[model samples]
Target: MITPMAIERTFVRTRKLATLLAGATLAASTTLVAGAAPASAAGPCGSSYSRVGVYAISRGDGTRTGTLEVYYSSSARKNCALTYGYGAYANTRSWKRVTISRADGSQEDTDANYYTYYAGPVYVSAPGACIDVAGTVPDWVTRELNNVHCG
Candidate 1:
């Protein structure tokens, strides 16, 4: 036989369980969402250039094995980009490239092939205008650090 108090207690318990289930569902959904950008590559850019941006290359396996870096030199008033590939390959051809473009449509690109390790410190003069920079490695994909302001 159900009394008024018993009915009230059962209702309260059911409401608490429903609230817990909703919180759990929300937490699970949050974990399923993906991030928009990749993590930073590694280490300092170098002595001459200060790193401005870092982008990860998209390999087919969804690994963060390759990276692209953008740098700026206050003294020289130039911006540079570089590419890096982790793990040396034996008898495997690898290359890295960087491109910089000016607002007036002038552009500069530098590329290097490495049988051993790193690629280049490709540069362009970034003065008084916005510049776009991009980098690439062979057989993979390229990443861009879009229009950045430099004075």
Candidate 2:
């Protein structure tokens, strides 16, 4: 499953057309290549750039848990985020009740949580508006799924 991190923050910045070149789309699609070229490859998103990152969080409430991270800009006009949930780990519970809180008041609360045991980072770029997350998806996302399916 895909996790979404919700952070809260405001910023303003120019939308630079940055390129993200990858090695092989089919091979390393889910894998994040380190120090990749600016326009090496496209991400698992519609936009040319990947902003939001998702991760799964282990909860103690029998119910599944997860987190989100919304990235902010300098001018308070641009923002992005990342998310992940428990389904990615195969928990079996819905992860919609989850939310990620950022330093800003902006929020990130979801009405659905299909992730329950599997989790990973879902990259997405926006039009500089939804950069306020509600919580954090934890660092384990990178540590756990870093090389699981990545080639």
Candidate 3:
């Protein structure tokens, strides 16, 4: 028997369930959007530079701690490098280093220090030659790329 009170209770329950579902959906969507966002659009290298290479910096146990990124500016005929810390190392003051050099060793730039996030936008002019890129995080986890992005 569907009395007036019974019908009212059922409608209230249904409305509450729908509201709960809607809230859950909204929360999930917000999380997805936030997680999809990139680290930085232009990165630490600036908008004029385009990323040319990326190498992973890992711990002795093979856990990734950061990345060594290389960027190039064709108009400027220059290459740049940076070491970006992440995971357990992110936003914590630690030793970091980034270096970029011409393959001939004619030009080199390096930045090394205790940084919270990253080290270096070190630049080297390597227009017609290859470039060497390297970076280091804490505990001597260093990664390098040699003779890359030539001509």
Leading candidate by TM-score: 3
Flag the better candidate by TM-score, 1 or 3: 3
Q: Among these predicted structures, which one has the highest lDDT?
A: 3
Worst 10 residues of 3 by lDDT: 37-46
C-alpha RMSD values across all candidates: 11.1, 23.0, 4.8
User: Which wins on TM-score, candidate 2 or candidate 3?
Assistant: 3
What global local distance difference test value does model 3 have? 0.87
Between prediction 1 and prediction 2, the one with superior TM-score is 1
lDDT tens per residue, model 1, 1-151: 9999999999999999999999999888776654422254233444556787778776667655567777887777877777777444222457666677664557676666653445666678868877877666655567766667556
Indicate the worst ten consecutive residues by lDDT in candidate 1: 34-43
Per residue, candidate 3 scores C-alpha lDDT tens digits across 80-102 of 89998878888899888998899
| TM-score for candidate 2, residues paired by index | 0.29
Instruction: Kindly list the per-residue Cα lDDT of model 2 for residues 42-140, writing each as its tens digit.
Output: 433223334434544445453434544333333333344344443443345443332332233344333233445322222222233333333323332
In candidate 3, residue 66 scores what lDDT? 84
lDDT, candidate 2, equals: 0.35
Descending-TM-score candidate ranking: 3, 1, 2
Worst 10 residues of 2 by lDDT: 142-151
